[model samples]
Target: MSLLSVRSLTRSLAQRRLLAIDELCLADGESCVLTGENGSGKSTLLRILAGIDAPDGGTGCFDGRPFAWRPYPDWLRKQVTYVHQQPYLFHSSVIDNIAYGLRARGVPGAERERRVAEALSWARLNHLLDTPPARLSGGEKQRLALARAWVLRPRLLLLDEPTASLDADSRRQTIELLRTFADAGTTAVIACHDRDVIELAAMRRLDLVDGRIITD
Candidate 1:
């Protein structure tokens, strides 16, 4: 069964239609990209799927259960995570930022430390462990954002232009980490135009036109 499914989805603002997806589905461990021109509703779709925004109309299901995004249920919140193009970070140290979610979820202190250490190594942020998240370089901040989410081991990840403004090396490192996430069975939907990201293993393309999926 699909991990997530949606049909007859619609969204509009100020009397302007934004999305009109007839049907869409994602399988467990699947990696897909959302491609479209600006205003084509890629971010809008990601926000709805991430439960950050509600659609005007739609029926959605996840893990064989109805997706009640309006109220944004606790179970779904625990299962899904979203990262913006310019991700947000706390005014705290990198290690603390990475441990924030685990702490909120009530993960044991030792386990949180272990996971934060693992994440730091995984994202190559060990060197910046004590640096303030807000003072890090763009790529460093992005990696921190990803590491923070990855530590939670979410089943589904929604990323908006994750590689938008990075240098070549930074982009490569970020893509490698994303590949690792996919290999570990985390379903991901990334909105981006980067060639490296588009060509990741087992990555499928979903092109949007005028807020509708033109090809999948």
Candidate 2:
């Protein structure tokens, strides 16, 4: 069964229609790579699904429950996570940043610490646990953001241009991390043009054109 399903989704900017999708579905544990030209609405679609932006019109089902945009169903919020090209980080240490979501969700201290430690190792950030986010390199920061979300163990993850600004080595590291996530059964929809990401063994491709998914 699909974990997410949307129908007749649409979005506009002033009079310009930014996105229009007749339907889109993702199965549990699926990995999808979104491809399109710069203005083909890749990011816009990701933002809408992430609930960071609302669609002009649409209906969705997540985990067999109704989903919404304006209020962004509270239950869905706990099940989906989004990370941008330039992720926002706390002003504190790496460990603290990864623990923020857990703390907010009222996870017990012992369990929180355990998850944070696992996340640190997952992102290969264990050595930098005490370092502030500001001190990290671009790739490191992106890893931190992924780790932050990973610690929450959200059922779905939406990533927009996650490797857009990284060097080759960093990009490779990021891809490895994504592979780890996929291995752990975390569903993902990634917007990217990188051939390596597009060719990931676990990913199926979706191409957006003229504000619509032209290929799947």
The residue-by-residue lDDT of candidate 2 on 25-67, one tens digit each, is 9999999999999999999999999888999999999989987
Instruction: Give lDDT for model 1.
Output: 0.91
Candidate 1's residue-wise lDDT over 1-216, tens digit each?
599999999999999999999999999999999999999999999999988899999998999999666787888888999999999999978888899889889999888899999999999999887687878998898999999999999999999999999988888888988999988999999999998899983468999998899988
The reply for model 1, stretches above 4 Å from the true place, is none
**Segments of candidate 2 deviating more than 4 angstroms:** none
What is the Cα-based TM-score of model 2? 0.97
Q: lDDT of each structure?
A: 0.91, 0.91
C-alpha TM-score for every candidate: 0.97, 0.97
In model 1, the Cα lDDT at residue 193 comes to 94
How many clashing residue pairs, candidate 2?
Answer: 0
Residue 156 shift from truth in candidate 1, angstroms: 0.4
Candidate 2: give the clashing pairs. Answer: none
Error of 1 at 109 (Å): 0.9
Give the 10-residue window scoring lowest on summed lDDT in candidate 2: 195-204
